[model samples]
Target: MKNIWKILMTITVVAGAALILSTAAFAASDSKTLTINATISARAELVLAPTTINFADNSPTTVSSVSADNPVAVTARVRTGKATAATLTVASANDLTSGSDTIPISAVSWTASGAPFIAGTLNKASAQSGATFGNGSGTYNGTYSFFLANNWTYNTGSYSATVTYTLTAP
Candidate 1:
């Protein structure tokens, strides 16, 4: 009888504790999330070293401009993304020809040395008194700008001078 009473008391206490806990309510909440992504791009442009140039006395005048040889303006430019240095060279190609009424080319010669007169000193850009360009990539890829000597000997006809350029990588 004593043991039966103790078991009954324990069961009654546990039931009372469970009933009190169930009576108490808990708060409820909800949440949401949002996400986004990004994109990007880089770019560059060609940089002309000698953007523009002018020859001191390139205009060919029969009598007045004879004494002095016409100076050629060389334009060197490049496009780059990284730091670099490059060199460009100009050489003359002897493809000179004359019209039917052609005067022998041997008789006439330009004051400037066999093409690529290179002004006073050549084979060096350090002597460039004119505009010089570099993109840091050390590579120059673009059209070369220069003035042809105005002094010429002919019977009145169109003439041409061929020039070749070699670009070097840094």
Candidate 2:
């Protein structure tokens, strides 16, 4: 009986040692590396409220400048480099015309209410900068109150002109 007990104890110790060693061997681990990539491109967006603006007739003597009924609300969004600049420009297709009469587009101008926005006259020959933004991605909001220089020399007939606003992000 003593010899049997000794053999059992020895077998148990050897089995325990074998189990611990097997567990350590199985503990070895390996990991696979994964790479991730994303792409972001430059983008620009612009919004103008009340696309059509009306300037009511007024006596040139009473009002030197005729203001539009409502100021235009503007919103500009841009995604650009940290060092790049964004710009908003306005250009007229042609002078205001009514039959054989005409009024120079430059007679129209605007005043802005927002940072970086500037007051400027409408130009038919070239684009005029309405706003200039410093580096980065952001959304800008502002208002443009337009006016037409009232002059007695202007034609008596109604005159109209088309103008375009452009936003650029680089």
Candidate 3:
């Protein structure tokens, strides 16, 4: 009887220890809850206006019979967005077209850029403002003017020529 009593006590002690260890285990309830996330951002794009060629402004400008500074200022604009720089090329070969008139302009060759430099402007007869840009809006502008020592030379009856303008990533 005494020996049986000792065996039962030993068994009781061992069982109690095992119960305590199991209770102290790591489990889903005791584990921490974690989280993660992701995000994206973007900006608007830049563009050009007059989006094409324009002749000298007919305002306060005079294509005098023999004046050098004939009011022949062509204008353009750069509607900005996410781009930093751009170049304007005459759209002759593989390019977009704009403008229609008998002012010796054509889908033939591009002359120059005007403003805001979405590309820049080039001059035909050197009028006034060659090329310029708007700072805040990322715009381009230009004017050109050269002297006509003899005006009688360009007085042709009617002419139609094409000028192409291209914009490059500058």
Q: Which tens-of-lDDT digit does each residue in 69-159 have in candidate 1? A: 2333333344344555444444443333445554332222222322222332122222221213344543223333343334554445554
Instruction: Write model 2 residue lDDT over 1-170, tens digit each, in one string.
Output: 99999999999999999999999889678789999999778899999998999889999999999999999999999999888989889989799999989999999999999877888999888999999798998998999999999999987898889889889988
lDDT string for model 3 (21-46, tens) is 88877444756668877653322233
Model 1 CA lDDT for position 81 = 40
The per-residue C-alpha lDDT of model 3 at residue 99 equals 36
Superposed on all Cα atoms, model 3 deviates from the true structure by an RMSD in Å of 10.2
Give each model a TM-score. Answer: 0.30, 0.82, 0.29
**Alpha-carbon shift of residue 159 in model 3 (angstroms):** 1.5
List lDDT for all candidates, in order: 0.40, 0.91, 0.37
Stretches off by above 4 angstroms in model 1 are 1-84, 99-135, 138-152
* lDDT preference between candidates 1 and 3, better one: 1
Candidate 2: deviation at residue 42, Å?
1.0
Cand. 2 Cα-lDDT? 0.91
What's model 1's TM-score?
A: 0.30
Tell me, by lDDT, which candidate is best: 2
